[model samples]
Target: MATIAHHPATGAEPAALRLGAGLMALAGVAFIGYAVIFFVRNFTGGFLELGIGPNEVDVGRAQVLAFSPELFRYMSHLHIALSGFIASTGLATAALAWFGVRHGLWWAYVTAIVVPVLALIIALPAHYPYHLATVGHLGLIYVATGIFVAGALVALKPMLQARHT
Candidate 1:
């Protein structure tokens, strides 16, 4: 006869961990969706959410075209690259949450928290100084950040407990 031993710490996942992972996953999806929007907007010109309409976009495009076609092309490349990076980060975050954080891995929890924080730290300040941080322009990111923060908080205790055990 074979004997099986079960440890409490290795039991079924806690509800808190599940909820936190779900929230983080939701935020990751939001980030991916935003990236898609950004990629489309690169071609469409102007952000409708920011109240920059077609006419404004057209005027801006013409000005940029007149200033330098190469510069305009470079800007397009930058937008596309930024969109790709955002989507990749989102995917990575979601994967970590689902596969790592949900399983109560401290490293996963730390990574899930760090990725977006680094991105925001690098990207957000430019928006504020440029006066581009309008509610319409940044509201979604704000909401997603809030959800991510909530998830990190919710999962923190469980992760700590798991680490000690």
Candidate 2:
């Protein structure tokens, strides 16, 4: 028989942490939704075309298309793999935020913010000068990243206080 350790309700967490956790959860669901859209839409047209209008092409899109068939195929695979990674990371961040909201765990606060920022960072190299073009201005990637960071900042106080205790 296994016993589950219960953590008493830590009382109402600071509003900031609650807000952060809520944002984290929102970001996670958004990521998962983005992944579904990405998979359904199928970014078979190379990287820059990802999350952007299919007819919208720019210099970067042209360059990516100039690659050899094998290279282009490889890049497409990379894009798909990245999508999966982002979805998984978002899900993990959201789940952890719940714990952070309840207990103010330092790691949860950090991860909630870091994961989305990391996703943005990951896009930097791959998307390059066309980062914004690759993923639309209103895309979930941009929106969720902002939300996660904002939420983390909002909750920073409690997280910091918890660290010293």
Candidate 3:
């Protein structure tokens, strides 16, 4: 007779990890969506119309000239890179958290908590120039990201406690 051995890490996943996985997945999707929007707005002829509009202070202020090949190229690359980073991070966090590894748990927790903070800081500087558009965009993106992060953090609490003990 053969018996199956139980493995703690590979057992039925914990509820926290499950929830964290879902949230991270959602965040990843959101980041991808944002990235696509950014790409459409900047790279193609879509231009400021889709975003803050050409006449917006950020555009008119001459911070970065619209239609400048260099500027658009830079923005395009930046948005694409950000999208890739966020989506990959979210997916990785979800998978690792699901596996219940200590390092994965910690990574999920850190990514959840840190990304939004950094994003908020970056968004703040744009507020003076972009005003409502900047605030609204930043609020929407970071808030959603924060929610996912909060969920990850909550799920990781047990792991966190284990470390302290």
Candidate 4:
């Protein structure tokens, strides 16, 4: 029987999950970076700048949008929510891929698959109004998400086999 062995989890097999972790980390960093830049340019003088509107809500988000006035609030919610989930997925995926492969944790693999799928599902609402506009965004969301999830699943191979001979 074939068996897989690790370096006693001495942080040696980090490469085991490197592919998945690396993808996740990269995606997460991108999300965080975009959020920072977006948050900055929203109120300040940048591409995300929005015209001051005589609008007030009890609990309103501070994000800016280039959509219709009626859609502004909803779009803000979508952007923030999508950004949050993407960033979260990225970070968790990195951790999952790294530790899961290193320590042979199936939960990490499962998480890798789950996080993106959930994020994509959450973004489904964006397609209702105008699918054309959201096409690119949705594509990006799923591409990045799918890659990591699929990568993690692929990386599970080495961990699933028995090691005892």
**Which structure among the candidates has the greatest TM-score?**
1
Of the candidates numbered 2 and 4, which has the greater lDDT value? Answer: 2
Q: Against the true structure, candidate 2 has what lDDT? A: 0.65
| Model 1: residues with Cα > 4 Å off, grouped in runs | 1-11, 47-59
lDDT of 3 at 42: 54
User: What value of lDDT does candidate 4 attain over all alpha carbons?
Assistant: 0.52
The count of backbone overlaps in candidate 4 is 0
Best by lDDT: 1
Residues 32-141, model 1: lDDT tens digits: 98899888887874623233444334456557768899988988888889999999889889888888888777778789989988999999898776566777678889
Q: Candidate 3's residue-wise lDDT over 1-165, tens digit each?
A: 211122478765446555665675566566556656755665555544233654453462134554575876676677667666655554554445444332334654565556555665775576566454554455556756786666666566555554565
> What does the lDDT read for residue 33 in candidate 3?
65
User: Any runs in candidate 4 off by more than 4 Å, and if so which?
Assistant: 1-4, 8-11, 14-16, 33-41, 44-82, 133-136, 162-165
- TM-score of model 3 (CA atoms): 0.59
lDDT of 4 by residue, 1-165 (tens): 333354675635435445645665555555455455444543343332122122322222333343355566565465566456556666776666565644556666567667656765765676556433243334554555566555665456555553332
Q: In candidate 2, where is summed lDDT lowest over 10 consecutive residues? A: 1-10
Question: Clashes in candidate 2: how many?
Answer: 0
Candidate 2 Cα errors over 4 Å, as ranges: 1-10, 43-50, 54-76, 130-138, 163-165
Clashing pairs in 4: none
Residue 140 error for model 4, in Å? 3.6
